[model samples]
Every structure is written in C-alpha cells, then in structure tokens.
Target chain A: MTSILETENSDNQTQKEITLIENILKKTGPSYTKYILGIGSVLTACLTIWLGLFITPKDEHLGNTVRLLYVHPPVAWAALYLAFGTTTLASLLWLWPKTRSYFWDKIAGASAEIGVLYLALTLVTGSIWGRTTWGVWWTWDARLTLTAVLLVLYIAYLAIRQLDGSDKTKANRNAITALFAAIDVPIVHFSVLWWNTLHQTASVLTPGLHLTVPLSMGLTMGLGFLCTTLIWGWMMKVRYDIELLKVVDSEIELQRAIMQRRNEP
Target chain B: MTTNERLLKRRKLRIVIVLAILLVIFGALIYEGLTNSIEYFETASQAVANRQTLGTSDFRIEGNVIGSTIKRKNEETLFSISSGKTVVPVISNGSPPQLFQPGIPVVLVGHFAKGNGPGGTSLLFLSSQIMVKHTNQYIAAHPNRVKIVKN
Candidate 1:
C-alpha cells in the first residue's frame, strides 16, 4: 500500500512540473520577439553580403570598388533615419508632456548614440571610396561639408544631455537641440544638387542606383534596415528600464533623507 | 508664473523660433537641388566619343596610359589614354604619379575642351586631379612599393 501511494505521489508531482513549465513558456512567449528580430537580421546581413560582393556588376570605371556603395549608402540612410526619429519623438514628448516624456527622452538618447555610429561609418567608408574614385580622401564639397556639420550638431546633442540639470529640464533642452539639428539632413542630402560640388548626386535609392541593381540587393538592404531598427529598439528598451530604476532609487533616497531630518528635529 | 518659470518659457520659445528658421533653409536647399543637378561617370573612350554631348559638363573618366606616349614639358604632362578602341589625349598641369606607368589605370576629373587647330577640331584636355588604380594583388605583391616610390 505504501509503495503504491509513493508512485501516485511521484506521478502527481511530475504532472504539476509539466504544467508549471507550460505556464512559464506562455508568459515569456511575447518577450522572445528579439529572437525573431535576430533571425531576420542574420538573414538580411547574409543577403547584403552576397548581393554586394557577388551580384552587382563591376563598374566600368570604379571596377570592384563600386561594391562599397552598398555599405556606405545604407549607413548614411540609417543615420538620417535616426536623426529624424529622435527629433520627431523628442518633439512629441515636449508637446505632450503628460504622455511618458521620460520615455521619449531615453529614446532620443539611444537614437543619437546609434546615429553617431552610423555617421562615423558613413564618413569613413565614403572617404575610402572617394580616395579610390575621386583621387582625394577628403573634400570641402557642399554635401561633405554639410554632413560634417550635422555630425557635430548631433554630438553636441549628446554632450548637452550629459551636462548638469534636472531630468525634465535636460530632456526638454536636448529635444529642442535635436529638432534644430535634424534640419541638416535635407540640406546635406541636397547640397550636391544645389552646388557645383565634387560629391555625386543622391542616388534614387541609397548611393543612387548604377543601372538597376539586382532585386536581391534591394531585398538584402531592406533586411538590413529592419534588423538595425529592431536591434536598436531592443537596446533602447533595456536602457530605459535601467534609467527608470535609477530614478526610483533616487526618489526613495530623497524621501528617506526627509524622514531622518524630521526625526532629528 | 514665477520669475524663473517665465524665463525658462522664454528660452524654449527662442529655440522653437530658431528651429523654424532652420526648416525654411533646409526646404530651400531641397528645391535648389531638384532644379539643377547632373551626374555622370564614364571611361576615357566614352568621354572622347561623346565630347560634344558632354560639353562643359562635369564627369569622371577612367583609362590606362599608352606606354610610349607620356611627355613632360616643365609643369605640364602629356599622355594618350586608351580604353578599348578609343584613345584620348590627356593634358595635365599637375604632377604625375611616379608609378604612373603605361597600362596602369587612372581616373581624371574635368571637362573636355574643344579647340580649332590643324586637325580642324581637336580635343583639349584639362584634369584637376589624377588617381592611380592598383589591384589588390599588385598592392600585396609589393607592400613597401608605395613607400619607396614618391610622387
């Protein structure tokens, strides 16, 4: 009788364990969104590499150096997207402070950081490609000049955030600066067309299309954009959580200080 | 409102005004670029063939120098570049690369000039800058070649 009871208890425990596991999986299912993002990113990165290195025809003039266009143009586009996104979000936050103003501030900070990375990559890749084709690594051409200004403005946006002020005030100030800096995007984009400059005109797509690139190339680039946005969004979410925790801790400390002072009196 | 609060509001208003001005400037630039802009890339042969079509238009041209035709008279260097069957005379006022030998690829940036001469009409060459194209294999073969060769 004892043995039969023990076996029944063991079976009951196993069934309970299985149910618990199923519940845990259900709860975490939505949070696994990053995995889907990761898969998409990997697929796009592979496609980009394949199309850029293999599918595109060698230029009659630039030869194999034309491949750099795929990488450089996308980076520049991503930077523009970052700047625009940050400015729009910041503006919305300021205009409607009742709705999660701190959240938008964190997003603006994240976008600016990502924009800096892409902007730097664009400059480096563009210079290298220019050196190969244009004979000069750097030129004071209108497009290049304006882009440099844009980079400086965004860098200043981050610097301003780091300087002393209350979180609310700092967010407002940085948002204003970001909105102003975003003006440089269209200016930089159009400078080549407006001025007699050495920099090439903007391509229909990124870096302008040299004839019609293979459909696979476009697909690959689309993938890259999607992946980058997903990864960036995930990172931003993580950072925002940390910031909120810090804010809560500070508030707790402030309240504790007030209570101690009252007790002493 | 308190004095400090009023001052902050004024500062924010100033920022809004500045941003509006910047937006106007950016809009103007876009309009300008859309109305006036031309981009071209060509080989030396194509540039020679379509000289009249590309008159005064800024373009990039690439070709290899004909081995026995490079000449120097003071600051000016003269050479014939061949891309397939097309040959073009390149007249550059700038210093030529030391490794700029025959059969090596070079890109020139400038416009073709039309001149009336003994040949009825001749193409006058003008290049502001020159770039030498070296293959990865060529560069890898002689890692210290660029260091030793001065242009």
Candidate 2:
C-alpha cells in the first residue's frame, strides 16, 4: 500500500515538472510582440524614405543632397550612440560581479554586431552625400578619420569574442574590449569641435538643444531616427533569441554528456 | 604527434602570427593618422599669419567666400576668402563643387603660391581643390528664394 501511494506521489511530481518546463519553453520561444515590432520597423522605414524623397523641400543651399540628411545622420546616431551605448552599458553590467550574467555579455556581443552594420551604413551614406556636397568621397579630416577608427575598433572587439576560451574568460575579454572601444565614441563626437574637420557639427543637438534645421527637415530627420532605432530594436530581439538558443543548446549537450557517463558507470 | 594534431598546431600558430602583425600595423596607422588629422586645416587668418613659416607646404585653409571677389578665367576660378580682417586670395585650378557660391564657407586644398600676390601686397593661395564647407543649419527653400534662384 505504501509503495503504491509513493508511486502516485512521484507521478504527480513529474507532472508538475513537465508543466514548469512547458512554461519556460513558452517564454523563450518567439511571440507576437517580436513580429509586431518587425512589422512596425518595416512600415516606418518606408514612410521615412517616402517623406525624405518627396515630401520634404529641397534645402535652400544643399538642394537634393539635403535628402541625404535623413539617411546619414540617423544611421550615424544609431551606430555611434544607440548601439555602442547599449554595448557599453551591457559590458559594464557584465563586468560588475554583483550584476554579472551571461545575459549582459550576450547583449553586448549582439548590439556590437548590429553596431557594425549601422556604422558601415553610416560610412557609405555619408560618403555619397560628401561626394555630392563636399566634393570628396573621403578625407582625412578629424571626424571622418575618427569614425573610421571607431569602426575598426569595434570590428576588433567582435573578433576578440571569437577567440577560443572558456565562457568566463571570453565574457571577461569581451567586456574589457567593449569598454576600450567605447572610449572612441566621445572623441568622435567632439572631433568637430576640438579640431578643424570637414564634417559639420550637430544640427538639432546643438549646445542649447536648439533646432538649427527648419521644422519640416527636423521632423523628417526625427522620423528617420525613429525608423533606424526601431530597426535596431527588432534586430536586437532576433539576435538575443539566437544567443539564448546557443546557450540552451550547450546546456543540453552538457546534460546529455553527464547522463551518458553515469549510464556507462 | 599525429598528422592531424600537427596540422592543427601549425594552423593555430599561423593565425596567431598573422593577428600579431595585423595588430601592429593597425596601431601604427592609427597613431600616424590621428597625429596628422589633429590639425586638419587652418583658418584664413591663421594661414596668413603663418605664411612665412608655411612657405610652399601643402595644407588646407578654411574661409568664407567674399561675394564680390569671385572671378573666372581660363581653366581657373578665382575668389577671395576671409576670416575676420584677413582675406586670402585663392586661384583654384578646377571648377568648384555645385554648392560652391558666394557667402558659403569652403576649404581649399593647396599651398601658398611661389611668387608674390597680384599687387604684391599679400600672398595668394594656389588651390588644387575646393570643398564646400556647409554649416549644420538647414533652411527650407522659401518661395522668394526659389524665384530668385530661377531668375
């Protein structure tokens, strides 16, 4: 009688365990929220392109090249401030023993990969605009040179993450490298002010937060900013999902290896 | 070691060496580039003040175009740029960019002419290229401005 009662209790316990696992799996899997964000990003990008190309007036001075303002500045802001800023904060969190987690390290790595994409876009778009307006495809001015350096630095940061190491060692290395690369962000920002560079200073983000550009141009640029940021957000979610899968797969593999060893013994 | 193990070891060593060399090259390039770009250009006033010391050296000068002084001749465009009270006469070898106009700032890349100025009162800058230096401000094309541009 006692054995039968114990077996019933064990069955109940297994049922509870299964329910818990199901809840976790549901949480980790993709949901409607990510898809909704992805759709929003696509729609906003289309709207930005439409308004930038057609609705906005040609700049009094820049003419049609003014349309590039929508592309270059927004991409640059996303790359330099948004993506790298997230990586820096996440790296700091990982470096802090109290807050250290694989979550932060994975976020840093994912954000940096996206940062590289936006940085390259920033360079390409800016180059096209420069050729039309500034009469050069590239120059060795302070701002341009520093921006190029920032790209190389982040590329190196990503490469460092690929080296063979234990998880802890890799995380530590990545976190440190991210912090080192982030030192260039402020320098790139202030280069125009500190040196004689061909690149112009901020338009909307001036010293007093004054809007230098006209209202229409400013609003279109703001929309472009929103579009790029939304795209970054959607990309981050997808990247984080992939990173979580890798972590989960490794955990499972480790468990399977231990089980096989136990069965052999 | 087995052949496979030896091959893997050789590959790892090769990667390490390549990475080390790349790191050194990158470091040197950044150092040199940063040092050179620190003072990328001089203002018209600054360039004029240092003309004696900067004789015939290739550099860039930044200034605003004096509206009344732009003139074009065969294969050359001539303009005067000013920063504060110092105005530098520029003789550019080619056509300026599309946006280049009076009252706009520009960065001219070249050096001081070998000889004296037009009247021998000041030096002339011989420019190989002209880059329009736009400000951050953006003004929409007003109706009046559009008509003016068309007329």
Candidate 3:
C-alpha cells in the first residue's frame, strides 16, 4: 500500500511540474534573462554616465559640449549599423527559399522596430549637439540628410510590416521592403566622406585608421554601446516572442469559434 | 506559354519595373545631395557676381576675416570678410567660436538679405552661424613624451 501511495504522489508532482513549464513556454511573465539584461544595462549606464561626465577631460575645441560624444556616437553605431545590419541579414535569410522561416521574419521585424527607436534618439541628440556647436538646430548637409532619410525608410518599412493580411503576403512585402532599404546603409556611412557639410567628420575613426579617443572617453563609449545593445537586444527578443504568441493565440481562438459554429443547433 | 508560366513571367516583369523606379528615385536623391554639400559655400567674390541668380536662397560664403573688422554690438558681431579682391559685410548673431580670429578662413552660413544702415540700401550676408575651417589631421601636444613622424 505504501509503495502504491508513493507512486501516486510522484505522479501528482510530475503533473505540477508540467504546468509550470507550460506557463514559462507561454511567456505569461518575465523570465530570468530579462532581469539579467535589465540589471546589467542599468548598472553599465550609470557607470558610463559617471565616466563621461566626470572622468573624461574637456575637448580642446568643443569644451563641455564634447560630452555628447560618449552618448551620441555609440547609439548611432548601434542603431545605424548593428540593428539595421541584423535586419538586412535576417531579411535575406527569409527571402532565400532554402532557409525561409518565420524565425527570420520575427528577428527582422523586431530589429527594425528597435532600430527606429534608436535612430530617432540619435537624431535628437545629434541635433542638440549641433545647435550648441554649429549655432543651428539643423542643416541640409549630406550626413544629416541621409540619416533622416534612413530613419524615414525604416519607419515606412515598419508600417508595411504591420498590414493585416495573410502571413505569407505580409512576410513577402516586409522582406522586399527591407532588402531595398538596406541599400541606404552604405550611403549614410559614405555621406560624411563624400559631402561637404556643417557636421564634422568622424573623429573616433582617426585619419590613421586608428581609434584616437582619450582613455576615459573610449571607456565611457564602450560601456555605452554595451548597455544599449543589451537593453535593445532584450527589447527585441521580448517583442518577437509576444508577436509569435499573439499569432498562436489568435489561431486558437479561430479554431474554437469554428468548433462552436459547427456544433450550433 | 501555359497560364501559370505566363503569370509568373508577368510577376517577374512587374518586380523589375518597380525596382527600376525605386532606383531612379534613390539615384536622384544621392545626386541632389552631392550637388548640395558641406562645401557648397561660395567665396565672397562669387557671391557678389552671382547675387542675382541666388535670390532668396540661403547659402554659405567662405572668406578671410578682414583685420580689425570684427566689432561687438548688442547681440551681434559685425565683421567684413574678403574673398579675392571683393569684400562682403557680414552681420551674424551668436558668439564666434574659440578659434575665431581675424585673418582665418571662416564659412558663414545664412541668406543674403537686405541690410539696415544709414542709407538702408545694399545687401549683406545675414549669417546665423560661423565655422572655422580646419584640416583632417589631428595632432595633440603634451610634455609626456613624443616623436614626430614625417609623412
């Protein structure tokens, strides 16, 4: 009798464990990695702020406005290069027949959304820095112009991704749009080198092809990139999971409604 | 051709046409950007010669600051910049940059608007901003220790 009772107890415990795992799979609550990323980002951001504002010396030319350097360039790199680059790669993967999957679509869409957010931040911070250093809020210069255009292109790409149609239709439309928008990446990068504009050329990329920032400034910028990347990556993963779950939940509801209609008197 | 193959061919053709249109638009934007650039500023002599053609359009003018021509008035800095043999009067708002000094090349960005003077007649470059032109090379000096390399 005790052996049979122990078996029953073990079966009940296994049932409880299954339910817990199911809840985690459903993503009804925050997960461990989210907490890790959140805490890491917050801590690193505080350190970068301290280093940028306190430890770095004032630039010879820009004075205190030089502090904008630590925040602006790293965010721009994350938005303009890393985020967009990933979107492009994911879009390409989705387009190719052999490797086509919703996984790539989810990544491309998530990265584009996060890219827009960071791109907008880059523009705002760049404008503030411009107003102080160049005595104007904006100029129709090459670098600024292309960056603005890139922001618009990706934003429109995002809007196209949201059209409520068949999954295949929306995926094809988004993939094609993304493939074309990726062309602007090289243009925005080369704009500074090719054009005459009020905005200064890149300083971190020294003429000697070396990074020439002061030690503290470099450290601050490195920290800034790490924190922003971690946070943005977490945001993208959360968003993608939610989107996939929404589709699955909607499908379940559709099947339930169909069954109810068939059983109607 | 079969119905399905014909349809596929038409879709391919449509894709090609759309891509062509996008290409033209992208090309135009890049071309326009190249024409209107950071160095779009004309010299003062060129500004004067082509003032009629440049009516109402804001542009930049590059010139050397004429000696002793920088004057401080309320909320404005009045200066004269010379390019070639011609001199243009400039009235710009905002404090000049740290590197701002007489005899250095500076680009003034603004429109050529009517000036207010005793006669209230001629036009001047009403600049909202000024920039000191420098080279791409960055060289920092300190007593820590250094070796200068020849290029």
Candidate 4:
C-alpha cells in the first residue's frame, strides 16, 4: 500500500512540474534597459526625419519624394541583412556540434523578434516608394514578391519558436527552422539582377559601380543608416535581456518545486 | 550502448538529416534561379530581332525616349524609343507618368503593333505601361522651372 501511494505522489509531482514549466513564460514587464532602448529609438527616429526633410537635397528628377531614399534603403538593409544575418549566424552556431550553446538559441530568438519589425517597415517604405515612383502601390514583380515571401518566412520562424515543447526540443527545432528560412535572403538580394522587374537595379555594388549621390543626399542617407543601426542594437539588447530573465524564472520555478517535494515529509 | 549514448547518436543523426535536406533545397533554389529566372527586358533592337515571338506575346522592350516624337493626342501619349541603331515607335493609351520626359531611358510593356506597311513589318508598339529607369540623381530636365500640370 505504501509503494502504491509513493508511486501516485511521484506521478502527480511530475505532472505539476510539467505544468509549471509551461506556465513560466507568462507576460513580463519592462526593465530600465527597455526604457533606455525605447527613448533612444524615438530620438534616433526624430533625428532621421530631420535629416531627411531639412538637410537632404531634392533629387534632380524625383523631386521631394526622393527623401524616401534615406528611410527605405536603410530599413531594408537592417532587416534583410543585419538582423536576419545575426539570427542566421546564431542558429548556425547553435547547430554546430563543436560550438553548440544555449545562449545562441536565445540570441537567435531575440534577433528574429526584432527582425520582424524591420521587415514590416521594409515593405511599407518600399510600397510608398513604389507608389510614388513606379505608379503602382504593389505588383507581383520578382523583387517585391520575393521580399514579401521573406517577410512571411521569418514570421513563420518566430511562430515555430513559440510552439509548446521541452526546452531542449524547442531549441533543436527552432535552430533548424531558422537555418532553413535563411535560404530566402540570397534570393531577395539577387532578384533585381536575375529578373526583369519594375524595380530598378541596385545603385550600389562593387567592381566599377559608383554611387553618385550629392553631398546633402549622401549625408542624410549616411545619418539614416547610422541611426537605424544604433536603434537596432538597442532593441536587440533589450530583447535578449528579457529572454535571459525568462530562463532565470524557469530555473527558479524548478528549484522551488524540488524544494517543496523534499519538504513533503 | 547505454541509453544516453544511443540518444546522443540519434540527435546527431537528426541534425545531419535536417542539414542534408536544407542543402538540397537551397541547391534547387539556386539552380532554379539560374535556369528559369525572368530576364531583364531586352533592348528594342534586341527584341526587334525576334519580332515574330516578341510581337505575339507580351514582352518588355527598353530604349531612350525620342524627344521630337512625343505627341499627346487628347488622353493618349504617343512616343518613340531609340537605342541608337533601332527606334521603336510606341503608342501608350494611358496617360504618361509625371516624370516621363524625352532622352530618359524607358521600358515599355505591351504588345507589338501589327502593320501592313513596308515589307509586312510592324511599325508601332501598343504599350500598356511606361516606366523610366535612370541614374540615382534625379537631374530634372528643366530644374529651374515649375510647371504645375493640372489634370
């Protein structure tokens, strides 16, 4: 009778542990770091707007709408190249047998969360530019289409990471999912050159291609790039910090459950 | 082998299988992009060479707008595009875009106009859309002037 009673208690304890583990990832509040990032992001955004409007020169052809040049390219660069690249590298590091680290999984998740925001901005700014320049708001053209696909793919990555699983299972699954979705980056980059599309070919590239931006325009674009990059870093740090907190929370909960079981004399 | 050893081996095998699949998928994507990717439209002269195929199916042809040839008849904007060697006459039913101008490189998307004049040749392109591609700097043809076109 005592053996049966002990077995039932053991089973109930295991069930409770699983439930607590699942519930540990509840909503979290902002910290001082999040506040700093939020303030810095807003300031940078304001500076970018000032640079674009007051300082930049009207394009020789596109006129004032040319100001979009600052926002569109920089946002797209951050999303598609910088944020996405970081996520890919983190996933790769986690997957590598020699370099596997739980920290990489958290980095991948945080960068990807930030990447979704930048990706949405990329589409919005690109659409605005297209509406003004291409005479159409959206088209099924290759470059635009491929970029839209990339946005959807990364959103899927975030969704997969949210699926309920054990910590190890989730980590393994998220790493593989991230590595798979990164395949679209090359396609988005080369879409302009590969396909005849309404979108113009890239103005900047190596091997004889030169950017002929006037001083004012160049300065604004440069400012926009720097500001967006700083903002991106700030956001990433905040996100990674929150992820670390969640991990700590989970560990504390597990420790508490163990102690409770020991005290149950 | 111990259960822990077997589990580790299985995890490694899963990683290898997943990576192999990803490699194959990416290889296919690159191959597809190379073989069947859309071509940036050919020059008007280039397309003119394959008029039989190009004229029937909707294709894109590009050239510089010829200034003297621009004619705005009521709602229609008619113009000719040139690439030094061959000039393709284009008639666009839709109104020209705001930045549309002479000497600018433009790509016309539409069908070839069938003609009975001169050795059964086609004279004009029936354009559904006109797009301009140029250098990064927008050098307004007449930068100093402000012509508020009311339509």
Candidate 5:
C-alpha cells in the first residue's frame, strides 16, 4: 500500500512536468520566426525615413509639400498589398484541403483590418497635402475616387468577417466572399487611368521614364512598404496563435468529458 | 427563413447600397471636375504679365499694397496693388483686412473690369472676405488684433 501511493505521486509529478514542457515548447516555437520578421520590419522603416527626409530634393513646383507624396504613395501601396494578400491567402485556403483554412482566414482578417488603417492614413494625408498645394481640401480626382471606393469595400470585408459565428462553414463563406470582392481592385486602377481627373498619374513606376525622380524618393517608398508588411505579418501571427490556443482548450474540455464518463461506468 | 440567411441577405443589401452611394459620389465628382474652371495660384508679378488674357475674367490676384494708392471715398475705398511692372487699381466698398500693407501678399478675388486702363480700373475687384497670413509667433503675440474679416 505504501509503494502504490509513492508510485502514484511520482506519476503525478511526471505528468505535471510533461505538461509544463509542452506549454513552454508551444510558447517558444513561434518566437524565432516572429523576432526575425520584427527586426526586418524595424530596419526597413528606418531606411524609409532616411530616404524620404534626407534624399528627396524639394520640388520646384510644390516645394515642401512634395514631402507628403513620399509618405502618401507608399501607404496607398501597402493598403493594396494587404487587399491582395488577403484575397490570395483566402483563395489558397479554399483551393487546398491540406492547408488549414482557419489559419489563413485569420490572416486575411488581420490584413484587412491593417489595410483599412493605412488606407485611412493615406486619405487624410493626401487631403491635407491637396489643400495646401491645390487650394482645396478635396477634389474629384479619379485616383482619389477609386481610393475611397477601395476603402469602403475593404471596410465591408472586415465587417462581414466579424459579424458571424467562428465555425468552419462561416469562416469558409466569408473567405470566399472576400476573395470575390478583390475584383474591384483592378477595376479601380484601370478606371482611374481611363478617366481624366484631378489626381495625378502614377509617379514611382510607369511604362516610359518621362520624369526623373530622385533616387531617395523611391527608396523611401520601398522602405515604407517593407515596414508596413512586416508589422502586418507579425500581427497576423499573434492572432493565429490565440485562435489555436482556443481550439486546444476546447479539445482539452472534450477529453475531460470522456474521462469522466469512463470513470462513472 | 433562418436567422442566418436573413442576416446574410441584409449584409448583401447593405453592400449594394454602399456601392450605389459610391457610384453617385463618383458621378458627382466627375461632373465637378469637368465643370469647375482650373486656376493657378500666382503672385501679383505673374498676374500683371498676363493681364491681357486675364482681362474681364474672374481670377485670384496676389500683390502688395501701393501706399500712395490708398484713399477713402466716403463708404467706398480705393487702392492700387503694385507688382512693380504695373499698378492694378482696386475698389473695395468693404473694410480692408488687418494685414493689408505695402509689402505683403493679398489675394483679391474678382474680374478685371473697366477702370485702370485700357489698363484702367485694371481689375473690377469684388472680394467677399480676406485672410491675412501671419506666422505662428506673430499670431500668438497679437491674437485679437489679427482676425480675418469677411466683407
């Protein structure tokens, strides 16, 4: 009887040790990937600031207000990146059975949220700059109109994702809808070009080099893109982990229920 | 219908409404862009050089006050804005802005009607309001004295 009790105590201690180890492993496993991405994001952001502030020359026409273009264009691009990223991820999840749809669905959700944030920033900054340069706070520019449309669409995307239950069917339905809504992006870009509006044409890259922009401006834009991407990626990972933990907790509850039933019998 | 189906239908309806609203906004914007005249912001010097084309048309004129050209005609006031090349006469029945001086940027909104010249009454000036540009330091020092007055 004494030996049996001692063995039982030891077994309990061993089980506790194993559970602690499992928890630690789970917590630490994603840290390395997240840290690398985080560091890269910081470095890119620093590079963007350096290029925008120091490298770009003041414009002959717009003067200091030209600085806004550096910040504004990249934000617009990052928003576009988010929209595209989410749609692509959603498509992949829907197509591939092997891929866990929930994981990418959460990522899509995160990207949409961040995309809206940057899009809002882009609009506000662009409007302020427009006021100073064009003597008006707002204009009926093609590019501006398209941007507004994109913003509303993605905001709808976010709202739809949040409204329903988190079951697999619900997630799949929302992901599919998001994927379909992405069709607007190309249409927006194309319509802006076709229509004559106050918004200027794309500056950073075009088919033929008509205007020679300073190298600093390009670097600044590139840096801004990298920083926003890294931040978005990190946020998606954190959210994904939280969802996984919730699933694990539910599974543990189910195991406890089975154990209780067996003991009663 | 199930609650879920009803909710989904409502969401779809909302999306359609939003899209329609956006379309109307887009249409209005296109119309405004096409109809509104495009004008460039310029100082008095540039305005004077292009006075021929600028004649008898609504424009935004920027210049410094010519000290001698200022005169009071009863309830009406007259002044000449000099860009160094030509002096553009301005007739204002309204009170002058606080910062109206011989050497500052003052934008006048009106058309150039018959006065200063074939060059007479160079600009048939009609301004409803005036804004005096001051530095942040200047504004802080004399906050009450530097208000923008609308005529």
Candidate 6:
C-alpha cells in the first residue's frame, strides 16, 4: 500500500539523519586538549592556594584577612567578566542573522551554568571577607545588593531555558533574556560610585590604573585569575560535549523507536 | 493523551511554577534594596543639616574621627566626627572597636540625642555602634620604609 511505502521512506530518512548525527558526535567527543586544560586547572589552582595562604605577606591594614583578596577578586572576575561575558557574547552571535546557529545557543547555556557556580562562590567568599574586614556578615549596601540581583537575574535566565518549546523558540527566548540580564552588569560595577555604599570601590582596577596592591600580592592574585579561567575553560569544554551528547542521545532513542515499529506485526 | 504527552505537560508545569517563584523573589529583593540599602548612610554634614527632620529616628552617619577629641568617661566613649566643616560630637555607650582610632573614617548607627549631657554640649549624637570604614587604597608596609596609610 502507498501509506506503508510512505512510512518506510520516512523511517529510512530518520536512519540517515541518525547516522550523520552519530558521526558528528564521534568527531566531537572529549579530546587530548580537554585533558591538558583539566590538568592545567588543577595544577594552577593548587599553586594559587599555596601562594595565597603561605607566601602572600600580611597586609598592613587588613592583616591576615588580606588573603581573601586572592580568592574573592579572582572569582568575581571569572563570574562577572569572563563567564557571563562569554554567555552574552554567544547569545549575541546566536541573535545575529548571519551567525545564527544552535552552536551559539549551547555555548551560551554552558557558559551561563558555569557562571552561576562562580557567582555563587563570589558571594560566599565575599561574605566571609566582609565579616572579617567590615565587621558584619552582611549589609544591604548598593554593591552587595546589585550583585545579589545579578545572581537572581541569571537564575531566571536559566529557568527560562527550561520552558517547553521548540529548539528555535528556546534559542530566541534565551538570547533575549541573556541580553536583558546583561544590562545589570554595568550597573553592578558602578553601584559603589553611583550610590552611597559601604563596600569599598575597586582597589586594583581603578580609573588611574595604579596598582593599589603591592607587587607580590598583585602577582599572586594574577595567578588566581589564571587558575579560575582555566577551570572555567575545562568546564565549558566538558559541558559543551554534554550538550552534543544530548542531541545524539535523542537521535538514538528515535532510531530505536523506528526499528521497534518496523519489527511490529 | 499519550504517556509522553502527559509527562511533557507535567514537566512544563513544574518549570512554570519554578519560574513564578523566582519572579516573586526577584521582585521582593529589588523592592527591599530600593527602600533600605540604596541610600546607605548620610554623611556627618548632611545628618547635621537634617537633624530636625531626622528627629529621634534611627539612622546611620559617616565621618572621620578626630583623635584629639576622643575621651573615655566611665563606660562611655566620647568622640567628635567631622565631615568638611561640620563636626558632630558622639557619645557611645560601650567601648569602641579594636581598629577605632583617630583620623580613620567610621560609620556610627544611632539617633540625635534628645538632651544635652552633663557637659551641656549644645549638639550631640548618641551612637549605639561604630564601624570602621576603610578605603580602597593599600600601602604595603615595607620593613625599611615606614608607610603611612591615609583613607
């Protein structure tokens, strides 16, 4: 019958698509480069911890609490600048007419997931530092408040991605939501300057570019930045692989269903 | 409906509920921040200018401590904080923090005094707490060079 032949043809097409997706997945699986990045992240992180805890001299004002500077600022940079910045950039690329691709969407999602982890660390480390230096565990200051809002905004972005929709529809929704969330980044950065805040302004990244920190502390903090960025890179590569695997997994499931139907009486 | 369709519908419902909760939390945070922490504290000069309007209500004032003016009487610590030309005398009920010193910036939480003390000062602010507000500048204390940190 014509209907039976049509169904057979559809199954054949699905089989071909599955074959193609499987090939792509095989080519894109974990590689030597990812392993190198993983090793580098671990080694650099250990070195940073050693230098921060032992080698870094006591700050004249902050004393032993100055060690937190190495952790807090680097984690903040990774979250606010490195990871979130990548998400916004990837989202922008996906929104562009010429560069629109699911690749950008996946990259945005992965970067954002990692960014949330780093942002949470930023808040935790900052709170510990705040308690020791500022004499309070928490305060409703502008910088702290806006940073909290930034975390919530990104949380909403991740939730929006979970809404049931077609791939294209989800991509569009995520891109727009990421763009909107990015509006808060600059506001959070300038909150101390724009408003009366208990939080101190930027120590190193001041307008004049003078290193507010000493040479030894600055170098250790720089190493911390490198360590965090490498960790982010390794995580991003693995997360992107997982996204690819999801596509392959769904294809395999469809292939199995088709074979089962063909075998049915 | 098929089992797949039912599962999809349930998942979507869960996501929607989560999104609603997040939305409410976000709204509450913004509202709380706008009213309470947006304007963190008034400076010493501003607080003095608006003392009558502020009345006995709890508020925070930021200023630099005048070291020479700091005095301890009984259990109370008395000090004068200045912003520009305006100086506000403060009487704290308890001992100040370890880092509390002259020429350092601090934020004091309290209200305008309802009455002049035994010394009969015309203007005085009653402080319940004092918090040292350090600056962004850092001068490394070299063993050879004695570094003076100015906030």
Interface Cα RMSD per model, in Å? 9.8, 2.0, 6.4, 6.5, 11.1, 1.9
Ranking by lDDT: 2, 6, 3, 4, 1, 5
> TM-score (chain B) for model 6?
0.76
Superposed by TM-score, candidate 1 places the C-alpha of residue A85 at a distance from the truth, in angstroms, of 3.0
Model 5, range A1-265, lDDT digits (tens) per residue?
Answer: 3488867876686587568558845874658889988888788877777766666665534456666766787777777756456755665675578886566776677677777888899899978876665445665445666677677677766656655455777677667767765766765555545653445556654546333455555556666777777877776677666666666666666666665674584
**Model 2: runs farther than 4 Å from truth?**
A1-28, A253-265, B1-25, B28-32, B116-122, B147-151
TM agreement with the true structure for every prediction: 0.58, 0.87, 0.72, 0.75, 0.57, 0.89
Per-residue lDDT of model 4, residues A164-227, tens digit only:
5687888899999998889989888887766766677665542265666666666667677777
CA lDDT, candidate 4, residue A180? 84
For B1-151, candidate 1 gives per-residue lDDT tens digits of 9997888777766666655665565555445434423232367777767766777555667788887899988998888788899888888888775446777777677767656632233565677667665432211123334333323
- lDDT string for model 4 (B1-151, tens) is 9996888677766655655664565555445444434554778887777776554567678888998899988878888999868998888988766778878788777877666643344868888887766444443224466763322
Number of clashing residue pairs in every model?
A: 1, 0, 4, 3, 8, 0
Error of 5 at A4 (Å): 15
**Docking quality (DockQ) for each candidate:** 0.06, 0.52, 0.15, 0.20, 0.06, 0.56
Error of 3 at B124 (Å): 7.9
Give candidate 4 regions above 4 Å deviation: A1-40, A205-209, A250-265, B1-37, B116-121, B138-151
For residues A24-119, could you state the per-residue lDDT of candidate 3 as single tens digits? 476746778888887887888888888888877775555577788778988898898889999999999999999999889989999999999999
List fnat per candidate, in order: 0.03, 0.64, 0.17, 0.23, 0.03, 0.57
Query: Which parts of model 1 are misplaced by more than 4 Å?
Result: A1-30, A54-57, A96-100, A206-214, A252-265, B1-90, B93-128, B131-151
lDDT by residue for model 1 (A1-265), tens: 3488867876686576566556644544445665666665577667777877887555433557767756787778778775456655666676575775676877777778778878888899989987776567865556766776677677666666665578778877877887887878887877766664656655444444542444444554565566566655555555555565556556556655665674584
lDDT of 6 by residue, B12-50 (tens): 888888889888888888987897677689999988777
Q: What is residue A56's positional error in candidate 2, in angstroms?
A: 1.1
On DockQ, the candidate that comes out on top is: 6
Once model 6 is optimally superposed onto the true structure by TM-score, how far is the C-alpha of residue A250 displaced, in angstroms? Answer: 1.1
The DockQ-derived docking category for candidate 5 is incorrect
Q: Rate the local accuracy (lDDT) of all candidates.
A: 0.65, 0.86, 0.76, 0.75, 0.63, 0.86
Pairs of residues at least 3 apart in sequence or in different chains that clash in candidate 5 = B113-B124, B115-B120, B115-B121, B116-B119, B116-B120, B116-B121, B116-B122, B117-B120
